[model samples]
Target: MAQPAARTGPGPRRAQDIFAATFALLTELGYDGLTVEGVAARSGVNKTTIYRWWPSKDALLGAALIDSRLFELTVPDTGTLRDDLHALLDQMRKLLTGEEAGAVVAAVLSAATHRAELAEVTRSFFLDRLGRELPLFERARRRGEIRAGLDPKTVIDLLAGALWVRVLLRGEAAPAGFVRETVDLVLRGVAA
Candidate 1:
């Protein structure tokens, strides 16, 4: 006897739906406010189904963090370091100004303080996705677009660190001209 046709697409599609729902819920409600039950309700899946895939909400959200293309900002290569940096900064300005950013920041911070796995996942996601920008700096240096002897990692840190300081520590939003000015200051050191 011929067996019934094997089911296809349901597992992967359901997983994607779950991740998307989790991200949406995280954005709407901070990590502390999120719950598996809410995600199940939102995704139309039973709570047991969520538990079977993800051992905890942190794990589910962690997976969602990597899956979501929300942080995939455009990093253009304009054949010149200055122009490329400016374009990247412009994209950052748009991201930083968005409502979702605040929510993401809050969720990550809260998770970091309470959940070790979540913190690791967040760090890994940032390093994997954002770290690619380092190559842009390296290319600029090789092409003599920017000063030689510059450390790509250091430069990336400075760029992201400054923005983080402004947003997380100072509680101020990045201004429109901040990115251009930042690139200039970093490339050409301050002078008396």
Candidate 2:
């Protein structure tokens, strides 16, 4: 995992340390089993420092999600809309199928049911990541790479919905070649 960019100015390093440590713990122990005290021990930072930074465990986890590169995936432009979408989905498939990814997904979903605020934060995190891919589709539309009259948001949701169903409900690994088929279906439409 990539480290957060170095912070300049006063008191930034402490905050980064706390966030990094929190993310490490969350990835390891998960949301239900995580504790601030464990974060303090793992980070070598004091509990007072954590409390001073974040009010609650959820808040810390939220910030950690943002700070960590676990959600910092970049959508690549491969000159064609289908290729670009495939690249992005391939990255997501890797993430969803990884060892730590399952725990991370479960943690986010578990947080959503009991904690509205955390849910919102997690939603924002996903939206922010997905938002990065939208402009690629828009650019492709302008280039006539995608079919006209197709809504970018709808296309995005369509692809994401399929992947999420597999990840969240079925708990099955995203199969290889799934992204290619999805991109083909999206571009060509559902017509036989």
Winning candidate number (TM-score): 2
Top-lDDT structure, candidate number: 2
Displacement of the residue 72 alpha carbon in candidate 1, Å? 1.9
Per residue, candidate 1 scores C-alpha lDDT tens digits across 31-112 of: 7778999999999999987887687998787777766555567778898777777787667666666777656766677668
Give one digit per residue, the lDDT tens place, for model 2 in 145-164.
Answer: 76767677787788877887
Q: State the RMSD for candidate 1.
A: 4.5
Task: Score candidate 1 by lDDT.
Answer: 0.74
Candidate 2 overall Cα lDDT vs. reference? 0.74
Model 1 regions more than 4 Å off:
1-17, 46-55, 146-149, 189-192
lDDT of each candidate versus the true structure? 0.74, 0.74
The segments of candidate 2 whose C-alpha lies over 4 angstroms from its true place after superposition are 1-20, 27-30, 147-149, 190-192
